[model samples]
Target: MGGPNLEVFKFGFYIMFPIGIMYYFGTNLDSKFSVDGFWPSKEQSNKIPTEPEDIRAELERLRRRRLERRATRLAEETRSQQDMAGDGA
Candidate 1:
């Protein structure tokens, strides 16, 4: 079951089949299937720090923000507990 024509056809099929499939499935995939507004817009996205000093500054800012949030949450919890205690008394 070996012939020159058949071997050439087999080689062509092997090469072309995957390329055809890739072209069909890969074209316009992001636009067609992607959900609109799922990704953050350029203005909303945070820029990554490129310099060492910038990175350190960003880390410090984030740390301070986190601590502030934690402090505020703890204060709210404490106030809620105090209110509950006063209501029971």
Candidate 2:
């Protein structure tokens, strides 16, 4: 006795979704809808490549560079400590 009208709820989705879609597409008539700075054209979709592999490669390269710099800094720190220890002896 305290619920929504069944007749009004019936076919609500069939009408609501289509109307919502129409309004959405209507509002975005002349602009590009993009996600994550990557918007692919229908024809260009075949050529741009997937995000996962590219992200993996880019992350690997960045990790390698970061590790290399860390190693270099560590080596320099070790060399300075050794020189200090030798001078003290």
Candidate 3:
């Protein structure tokens, strides 16, 4: 049978080994002195207007322009084909 001394040593080593390693490597004192403080007084502009209704209106205008251009191109293609057919017949 193992003695009580061996059991105590095993428990102490299991608990203290990780805490000792963490204490030794975790605290970096030199890097704490070299940090620059943040500038807290910078002026920033609110350039973007955050209106969803204005965005929706602009999107609808773009959609209408795109559909108008597509319809115009299709109508011009159809007219050219009709003119070519009439000239051949």
| Model 1 segments more than 4 A misplaced | 1-38
- List model 2 lDDT by residue over 1-89, tens digit each: 53577656766977899899889888865574645547767777754436999878877988999999999999999999999999999
Model 3: colliding residue pairs:
none
The reply for model 3, stretches above 4 Å from the true place, is 1-49
Model 3 has an lDDT value of 0.83
Taking the tens digit of each residue's C-alpha lDDT, what string does model 1 give over 5-70? 999999999999999999988999987789989999999998999999999999999999999999
> After superposing candidate 2, which stretches have Cα over 4 Å from the reference?
1-50
lDDT of 3 by residue, 38-80 (tens): 5444455333436998788877988999999999999999999
Query: Judged by lDDT, which candidate is best?
Result: 1
Q: For model 3, state the Cα shift of residue 67 in Å.
A: 0.7
TM-score of each: 0.55, 0.43, 0.44
**What ordering of candidates by lDDT runs from best to worst?**
1, 3, 2
Q: Could you tell which candidate, 1 or 2, scores higher by lDDT?
A: 1
